[model samples]
Target: MTTTRTVNRAARIVLPGVVAGVLAASALAGSPAHAADEEVPGLHLVTLTGPGTSATPPVTGAPDAQAVLLARQDAVLETIGGPATAYRWTTALNGFAVELTADQVTALESNDDVAAIEANTVRPMAGHVDLSAVRFSRSSDPRASRGAGGSGVVIGFVDSGIAPDSPLFSEVRGLGETRAGFSGTCSPGEGWPASTCNRKVVGAGWWVEGFGPDRIRSSESLSALDVVGHGTQVASVAAGNSDVSVLMNGRTMTSFSGVAPQAKVAPYKACWAAPDPADDGCSTADLVSAIDQATADGVDVLNVAVAGPTTTDTVERALLGAAEADIVVVGAAGNGRSAFAAHASPWVTTVGAARGNTLRGRVSVVGGPAFTGASRSRRQLGPVALVLGADVAADGAPTEDARRCLPGSLDARQVAGRAVACLRGGIGRVDKSEAVALADGVAMVLVNDRPGALVDDFHTVPTVQLSVADGTRLTRWMKRHDRTTVRLAGVGIEKDASEAARWSAPGDDRASLLKPDVVALGEGVLGAVPDAWALFSGTSAASARASGVAALLRAKHGHWSASVVRSVLTTTARPLAGTSTLVQGAGRVRASLPRPGLALDIAPTRYRDALEDVSWEDLNVSSIIMRGGGTTTRRVTNLGTRAEYFSVSARGFVRHRVRTTPVALRLGPGESASVRITVTGGGNPSRFDDGWIVWRGARGSHTRIPVAISR
Candidate 1:
C-alpha cells in the first residue's frame, strides 16, 4: 500500500524568492563566501530504475527490498555531500527531489544507478459550467439518470487549495455518502482541520517542501484552506455541492452548480500563493508528489488545472502512470493562444476553453449607436459627460499612464461626475476600475485592444467594456467633438452559442495526434471561492469541467476502461460551427453521455509505440490524424446489446478526399471489426483540412470521429 506524507517542517532550506521581503530574509541568514560549497543553485529531480507503488502484479522481492532501494538512492546523494531531500516518491514514480549545486547535478547525470536527472520547473495555475450549456438537463436527457450526480466517483484536484468553510462544499441534506476504495486522509494545518473533510470533501493535503516558507505570504495558510481562491474555484466547478446561490460583490448573480455536483472532492494543494502574487505557482517537485499521492489514493478522476510543457516531463510521466492505473487524467491547454498546447501527452485529455454564456453591458453614445460587451456590473448610470482618460491625467503624470487608468494617475477635477474611458493593459482590469472610482468617476468604460476572452470581472464602479474596433471609433468621436456624453445601459445575461475563447491555446504542430482533445464551457463561469463566489475563465477552468464529465462517466460505467471513456467522449462530442479543429479540437464536450455503438481501446504497449514514433496516424483512437494524404486502419468493438448494421461516410474536406473500404459493416454482440480508410490530397491551395467520419447505425446511433490533415 502507498501513503502520502509530508517532509519534516524543521528541516528548512533557504531558497530564492520573488519579493523584497524574502530576498532580505535570505540575505540576513548568512554570507555567500562562508557557504559557497553548500550553495544550492537550483532544484533537480532524479529518477531511479525501480518499481513504483502501482506496479502491475505488485513488486515481490526479499524482505530487505526496501532497505536495498534506500541504500541505492543514498549512494547517489552521498556523492553530493548528503544534501537534504525536499521530496521522495514511490507511489506513482520512483524518484527524489533535491536542491543541488551545478556540479552535483552534473555528477548525478552520469551516475549509473540514476535513470534521469532534470531541472524542476514551476507551472502557473490555469473552471466551469452552467450545466445547460453541456446538455445537462434533468428534464429531458436519459443519460442524466445513469450519471446519478457522479455519486460513486472521487475527483482529485491538484490546485491551490479548497475553502472548507464555503457553503459550496457543505454536506447538505441530499448529498451522497463518500464511497469506499479511497485510502486518503486529511492533514490538519494552521486553519484547516481534519474535521473539515466531510462527506462532500473526502480528503485534503498540502505540499510546501518545494515552495519554501519564505516565499509564502504571511497571511496565507500553511494548510489546505485556500487564500488564493483558484483551487477552491476549480474544485467547486468540478464537484462541489450543486444549486448554490452565487454572489459577486455581495450581489446575487444566479444559482451555480458543479458539473458533477455529488462527486467526492480530494484536494491536493501542490501550489502556494507567493508574497508577490504574480510569482505564485506550483513547483515540479510538489506537482509530481501530489499526482503520485492521488494515484495511490484510488481517485477515479484527476484534474490538473496548472499549465505545463507540451512535451513529456516528470509530471507527464506521473500522469501516464495514473492513466495506466485506470484514473481519468484531465489537464489544461495553456492560455497563451499560441500553437503549443500544454499537457500534450496522449494519456492526458487536454481541454481548451469555450465561451458558453456571458453577462453583456451596453455602452450607448447619447443619440448615437450602442455597443455591447462582456461585463459583471449591474448598476445603472445615465447620460453623463464622457472624458478621455488622457484628458484627466494628474499633474506630472504620463499621458499614457492616464490612458490606461493607472492608480494615482487620474485627476479628480476632470474625472468627477463623468464616465472615464480607460484602455486595457498595464494593470489588472479590476484595478483600472478602482482607479476610476478613486478619482470619483461615476462610471468607467474599458477598451479591449486585442482578441481574447471577454471576462465578467467584478468592478469597483458601474463599468461597461467596449470592443477594440468600437473603442477606436469612440475615442475618435470623443476627440472630434467638444462635449461627449453616453448612457450606461444595465447588464444582462446573453448566450454565446458555442464559440471558442480566443485566448484558449491552440493545438501544437508536432503531435501526430491532435492536442486539446476538446473544448468545454469555461468563460465567465461562476463558482465558489474563499467564502464567496466569483467568475472564472481560461483553459484551466475548462479542464476542471472536463474532469467532472469524466467522473460522471466513471460513476455510470465502472467497468469501462479509461481509454474507452476517452473514446466515447471524443466520438460523441458535438462540433462547434465556424471553429477550426486546431483551436476547438473535436468540439465542445457534452454531458449527455451517449453510448457509442462501437468503442476502440488502445493497449498500453501500443500507446508507448505510437508516442515514440514520429507519425502514428492509426493509433486506434476515436480521432484520426493524417499528414497530407495517407491510409490507416482502425479496429472497433461492438459495445451495443444486439446485432447492428452501420454505414460509413465522410464530410467537410476542402483539400483532401477520404474513402473507407467496405462501405457497410454488420456486427453481432461482442464482435470486433477493422476498417481501412484512405485519404488522397486534391492539390488545392488549402494546406489543411478537417472533417468528420460518421458511422451511422441502423438503430439511429451516430459516432463521429474527427479527422485533421496537415501538409
Candidate 2:
C-alpha cells in the first residue's frame, strides 16, 4: 500500500467520544510498532496469526523465507515496521516469518499450505449482557414511559418473517408467515459454518421471489427465514401489538408492547423458514444489498441481531450510508464476558444487554422418578444442560414448566412472608426477585434447574446458580438447606445491555466495542410470541426493544442525526466504571426518554459551585477552587418565558470521572439565580483540571455549557 493511502486511512479519523473513551483504555495488546527480538530484547517481534480458522489451519506458502506460525484466528490485519512486520493470524510455519498484507493472507488460505481457518466470535464478556437491545435503547431514551410515535417507521427484521397469526403483531403486517421444516440444521454451535447460529426460523420473502419465473433459488442464493422463533421474538419485541385479549402466561394480560409497535416491519429472509435452517452465508455483498433494499423501502430502522466474524468491512460502509439516510441500526451485544468486540461503528449505535430487574424469580425442579435415587444418578451424572430448552432447568431451560406465576396462585397471605420457588424458567432471575418482593411471605426466591450439566443457571435471589445435575439432586434434597436448591435473590442492577446472548461470536476481536454489550432477562421474558404469549431470551429480544426505543426517538426528533442520538445516549448514560475504563464507554443506559421537565447538557471543565455544591453528585475538587466557606452554586438566567425546567449534572475530570447528581431547578425568564449542587452517586473523576456542571432541558437536549465548581 502507498504511504499516502495509509496516511489517508489514518487521516479519515472520526472517533466518537465513547470510542475515544474506550480506545483510551485500549492498552496496546503487544505493540503498535514492529521491533525485532534482537532490537527489543526479550520481546518477540514476530509475524503471527491469520483469519477464519474454521475447519483446519490456514496454510501460508512463503518459500525460501523464514516462516513462523503465529496463533490462529479470524480477521487478518497487518502492521509493518521498517523491514520488520507483524501478522494478526495463526499458521503452521516451520521457520520464522515476516509480516504480510491482508490480501496476502487471503491468498495463503487458497494455497495448500494453510492448515486451519479463523472463525470470529471467540471473545467473551463473562457475567455480561446481551447487546441486541443495547444499541436500540442507546439510540433512544430508555426512560420515556410513553412513545412519541411509531407509525410509518419500518424496522427490517432480517431474520425470520413474522408468524402470520401471531397475536403480538396484531398491529403489524407479516404476522404468522411461516414455512415448514426450518430447524435443527445449524452446526451444533461447533460447526465451522461461516456464521453458525442456533435460533433459526421459516418464512416467505417478497424481497426474494418464491416460485415465479426467475424466482426459484437455492441455499447459496437465498436468505433463510426464521428457522427457530428468534426472528419472531425480535420482530415482536420491535413491533408486536398482540391481537385479542392479551393472553400472557395463560391469562388475559395487557397488550404486549414493542420498542416500535407501530413501526412497519420489512421482513427480509436472511435465513430459511424451516428446520432446514439454511446455512446461508451473510456475505458482505448480500448484507450491503439488504441495507440498500431497506433504504430503498424507506426503512426507518434495521434490527440485525446477528453475530459474525469481523471480516466484512464491506457492510460497514453500507451501515454508515444507512445512518446518513437517517436509519437507526441495532444489533445484539453478545453473551460471554472474556471476549471483546469493537464493531460499534461511530455511525452505528452498538447495543449491549441487561436482564429483567423486575421482581419475579423461579426454581424448576423435577420430582417423581426424575428425582428418585435411581434417577438421581442419571440426573447427577447427566445430560449436559448444553442449552436451556424453553425449560426451567439449570443445564437447560424448563420445557413447559418455566412460568411466572403458578396456576394455583400462591396466597398472598401464605406466601407473602415466605420466599417463592418459581423455578428459573419463564420467570427471569431478576423479575422473579421483584415478584417475590411482592408476595408477602415470598421472603426469597430459590431457583433449582433440571438435572443436566453444561450451562449454569443464573438467579437474582440469595441467588444460587447450579448445574443441571446439582439442580436435579437439589429437588430430592429440597427439605435440606431449605430445598438444597439454594436461595436466589438479587443482583442489584438492571440495564438493557443483554451481554449474555451476544457472546456467541467466535474469535476474540481484541476490541471491547466488538464484544458482548450487556445482558438482559432472556431466559424467560414475558412477551407476545407468534401463536401465543410466551417468554424468550437472547440478545435478539433485547435488540428489538432497543430498536423500538430508537423508533420512538427518531419519531420524536425529526432530523436528529445518528451522532446526536448516540451523543444523547453516551452523554446522558450512567458511567459504568468506578473509574472510566476503555470497556464500559458510558455507564448503563437509561433506556427511557428523558423526563419532560428535566434537561442536562454540560461538558467536563474546571470550576466550582458556591451553594454548598451538594446537588452536584460528582465533580473534581482539584479543579474547583472552593472559595471560603462558600457552597457550590450556579447562576442561570432563564431564557424561556414563565418557568424553564432543566436538570443539572456535572462530571469530574481525569480517570474515574464522576458526574454530579442532577439538581432539579426552575428558572423564570429574565431571572438570574444561584443554584446549589451536590455530589450524589456515580464514578469518581480524577482526570480533570476541574469538574463541570451542565444544564439539560426537558427537551432532552443539553445546554452543554460547562459550569465549573470553584475552590
TM-score of each: 0.79, 0.46
Computed on alpha carbons, the lDDT of every model, listed in order, comes to 0.72, 0.36
- Give the TM-score comparing model 2 with the true structure, all chains together: 0.46
Q: Candidate 1 on 1-711: residue-level lDDT in tens?
A: 000111111212222221110100011111110100011137777766544555443556634544555676788789879988988776665678898887786676566666556566555677221211111111111112122377868899988889887766776655565657788899899898788887778888888877766778888888888888788878888886766655434544456678887788989999888887556777777888899889889898999887655545567667766876678889888665533567766677888877776678988888676888877677677889999899999999999999999999999998999999999877777778889989999889998767444556667777877778888989988988898889887668876654887667777544576778898876666666664555566677788888888888887777778887787777777889877788888898886567667777776545444443423454787777666778888887777889999898998877788999878899997588998889996696347788888888888887778888875
Per lDDT, the best of the predicted structures is 1
What are the clashing pairs of model 1?
127-541
Total clashing pairs in model 2: 271
Provide backbone clash counts, one per model.
Answer: 1, 271
RMSD of each: 9.2, 17.6
Q: Write down the worst ten-residue block by lDDT for model 1.
A: 19-28
lDDT of 2 by residue, 505-566 (tens): 22222221212232223333444443444444544555576677666666566555443444
C-alpha lDDT (0 to 100) for residue 704 of candidate 2: 35
